[model samples]
Target: MRKDKITSDELARLCGVSQGTIDRALNNRPGISPKTKQKVLQMAKDHGFIKNQYASSLSRGTSNLIGVVMLNLKNEFFSQLLTSIESTARSFGYTTAIMLSDNLEQVERQCVETLVGMNAAGILLCSVIPDPAYGKQLLQYSTSLVSLGNHICGEIPHIGIDDCAAMFDSTRYVLRHSYDHIYYVSPVLSRSSKENIDAQTQRFKGFEKAMALQPSVHYTVLRDPDTYQSILKSIPANGGRSAVICSSDSYTIQCLQLFKNSDVGIMGFDNPTMLRRLYPQLSTISYPIDAIGQLAVKTVLSPVKEQKSHYLAHTLISGTTIK
Candidate 1:
């Protein structure tokens, strides 16, 4: 018989219990006898009686929904990564609930809380929590939870690239090209007890280290949007040979569009499909987005105690944009 087709009356008959008792046992209500609970659960296991999650949750007043919080769904890279995760979740017969927080720490935390309130079976967090105390508090919940891209550090399992290593490798690649004036553009960097890792800081360290070895190259870091636009305005005037690197593909792509003229070399992190197709000359680092999604679903469903931490490395996608 199809599991979803099974009803409470059928389960009660199978377990030799009253419908009321089965309801109490499944819902974890105090009135159900321990002996009866064990017998019902065992029978359910043997006969696949537990397969009807929707009906079961309806009787129990909640569900096994997997909640996902993505910080920047508008970013094409993140959107692709999230879609992969959602697809994996669906394959496992899990319903997904997604919340977008626009990369705000406050909104991210709220999204998590909202998911929990919905009785999530597990939560896949893809945002940085601004408050460490709340992250610690989140551990108290019995729900299975994991983080992606950004993580909650020790409290949660994460599936993502070693941001530090990816940035480092990308920077090293840029430096190897012998761009005399290498620059990095990033969204403003912020420090929080909740966010232990800084992707930009690690990337900057790589840039600095590389430049130190090559004393001849002049290096600069620009975070200002106005300065970025100003720099782009003068790219053609300065000559086409100089290179500019961006921490994000979106930023680099936007800057390139601003200049209109493809005189200067531009490289970005994250090998977005559109970027590669639109500007064949744009060099990038391919962060394994699909793999990250695949691993996240595997890790979240795996027993937390047996979960292993994985760090993916990035690959350089060289293009004619840079020498």
Candidate 2:
């Protein structure tokens, strides 16, 4: 049979099995021997047989596609999360359909409508908008919905790190190292819209609370547009030990380069690879990216229950940057 024309019948013939047996094995239906199933699957793989998921879904009245909606992929953290979510979903015999909202509520709504219209099996959303009303409207589409990172809708199951606690710990870690000044630098909190403000706000609140406990320690928040220049000037002129808690790894790396010759302590979030290489000794708060992805899929597929949120823990990884 021609490569492009290879069908289930051709695969069955090559495997010395009936078409019925091939169907059962390929679809993972019971009643087929393990040996026969393996042989059929191997033959299908060798022949480059690609199952038509859309056609199969149409026949079964349910799609195996899991829809994922999140903010922009400019941040390495979100990109890593998307990769983990896709890989985890595929391991369970499901495919992913991804959409980006660029932190716009309207764009996020449009993505949701499109996924709903396509009858996606479930949706894993790192919601740009934190509006419960919009989330309620999404529930009318009849697909399982799970929130990632941010709790956009209170009713939906959410999987995320506790931003407040994570930041609070990070702040205290830096403080304990004899840093007299703490600078919380976050571009998002300064410029993001309401749809993208939840996580940043929580982190800021955590940083504030930690600073409040140490009244003698000087602290300042540097938003975007001016943060870079401000850090460059402040760290050197402060005349004392100072530390910067960057909102993300990208920002942390940027600050690291700026302070490469200075003695400023730096801490970053998400622990990206670039940060690891640039400053393997950089302190960071590690988010459970893989666990978040796996749990998001699990929550969507599991039966509905009282569990509305799953806040995974974050770890404070110490390095030379903090000391």
Candidate 3:
């Protein structure tokens, strides 16, 4: 027999035991004598036997693999989230199979289908599409789905930060600095597909709410592909105090570079380590990304019931950029 392709039946025959006994011994299932189990394990180890978890799961009609689907892994937040989820799932005796969607709806759908084909016990998805119909399709395959970052408008359990509250608090922090002009800077969604608009809309609503509370203050919203250039032109030439509250850390870092020599207060969201290391003075609302990962795993493993959404809290980390 080939050492690499050693099977349970082969091991059982060599050990003078039934295949059922070998299965029970290898999986640590009940109904096996300890002495026989030890002997079988040693013999299998000596013969270079390696159990196939996927095949075993297929035979049992269930899987211990948790599927994780997300957008591109270039961002620090997504990378950290993947690591946290993998680590947390392992503690629960589950393994993770991660797939990147590259922020494409079709890619996301394909990844979900592949995971379902693998019989993933549960899926933790950072969906590129937040449509109810798409969400329904996902539920048709498996009800054990936990959405991260963005929530679908359906009965899908969601684990993410309250974008409205996080942006509101970040806006208030910028207001406290007494800047005369406060601007909410976000990416222009005009080119984005319909399915990818929910998250941006939610954050914009929070910014609008905070701006409404201070009607007397001069505030504006700049939706631009080149936020730094637009913000630079918007600032008064005669040295008026201006501050920018960006919807993401990447935009905030760009704004920081734009106003490096000026006294402009800047606040961003998602306090990533790279931003902190490069610009220690940058202020941001730090979302509980690690907690989101842990909560997602717990939600996936729990018994399927009514869909529920979980909102983790965000912290406003004060830094020199916010003055």
Candidate 4:
């Protein structure tokens, strides 16, 4: 027998015990003596036998893998969220397989198929898919799903921020500050070759509702493919104190780049840690993204998932950008 990659049976033979005894020791299951387990573990480690629990789970028709699907990694908020989810999942002894949908419905559908085929225990999706019927179809596979940023399906619980409420409050904060003009910046609609998106769509709706509170206030919804370019032309040349509120911090940061110190009040949603630290003066709606990750892991892995959804509180930060 090779010294490397010792099988469980081989380890059992070397330890002079039954294969079941070795199995119990490696898996830390009951019915094995501490001394025996310690010896088996030490021996296995000495021989470089790292048990493949993932493969074993597949054999047992179960899984300890969490599937996480989202849009691209370029978005600061999504990147931060992914890290939180990964770290939280690991604490619960579950590994994760992450896939990016690139904001395409077909790509998201394929990602779901692949994760399901891999026997994933749960899928945490920041969904891009447009149809709820597809969500029902996934349920047919008896998969446990939880949504983070988007509402891929209403059935899936939301463990993230309430985009509508947060954005509404943020917009109101801007209005209260008395900016003469407000430019609402968002990616526009959730559309795929097929679909916030789960939250992104709601965010715009929230902004609209908030704007209605002051119908007379001059506001422009800059939601084009080239939204930043529009911003340059949209702001009044007469210099009436204007403000630009983006749906996410990524967009807010982009504005800072385009119009550095130009005196346009810039506000954004989702105060991501890195960005916030780098641009502390950026006004934003701060959501506990880290907590969202922890809750998502617990909700998905729980045997009884009684809670259908969650709405964590968001704090509005009145930073220098508002002035």
**RMSD in Å for all candidates:** 7.0, 3.1, 2.6, 2.2
The most accurate candidate by TM-score is: 4
Per-model TM values vs. the true structure: 0.77, 0.86, 0.89, 0.92
Off by over 4 Å in 1: 1-55, 58-62, 190-197, 304-307
Candidate 4, residues 211-265, lDDT tens digits: the string is 9999889987766665556655546464789988988777777787766757888
Which regions of candidate 4 fall more than 4 Å away from where they truly are?
A: 190-196, 233-238
Off by over 4 Å in 3: 1-5, 16-21, 28-38, 191-193, 226-230, 233-238, 304-306
lDDT at residue 189 of model 3 (Cα atoms): 51
| Residue 322 Cα positional deviation in candidate 2, in Å, after optimal superposition | 1.7
In every candidate, how many clashes are there?
0, 0, 0, 9
Tens-digit lDDT track for model 1 on 1-323? 54444566788998888987876776567888799999987766666654566566655555657788876666788788878888998887678888987767778778888887777778887766555576678788777778776556576676777676676777777778766677677654434343534455666566666567778777667766556667656666664356787877878777678655655667788876666688776777788888888788778776544445677877888877667
Candidate 2 residue pairs in backbone clash? none
**lDDT by residue for model 2 over 1-323, one digit each (tens)?**
55554777688789998978987898898999999999988888778898767777777666889999988888878888888889989998888999998878888889988888777888888777755587678666668898886776677777888999999999988888888788888877765656557777888888998888889988878876655566656677778888889877768877888887888888999885555666777799988887888888888877664447888889899987778
Enumerate residue pairs that collide in model 4. Answer: 150-198, 151-198, 190-195, 191-195, 192-195, 196-199, 196-200, 196-201, 197-200
Residue-level lDDT tens digits of model 3 in 1-323: 64664788889999999989998888788999999999999999888999888898889766889999988787788988898899999998788999999878889989988888888889998876845688777777753788887776558888888898888888877887778888777764543455556666778888888888888779877776756466555575636788888887767767877778777778888887667788776688887878888999999899755587888888888988888
> Clashing residue pairs in candidate 3, if any?
none
lDDT of 1 at 144: 74
lDDT (CA) per prediction: 0.71, 0.82, 0.81, 0.82
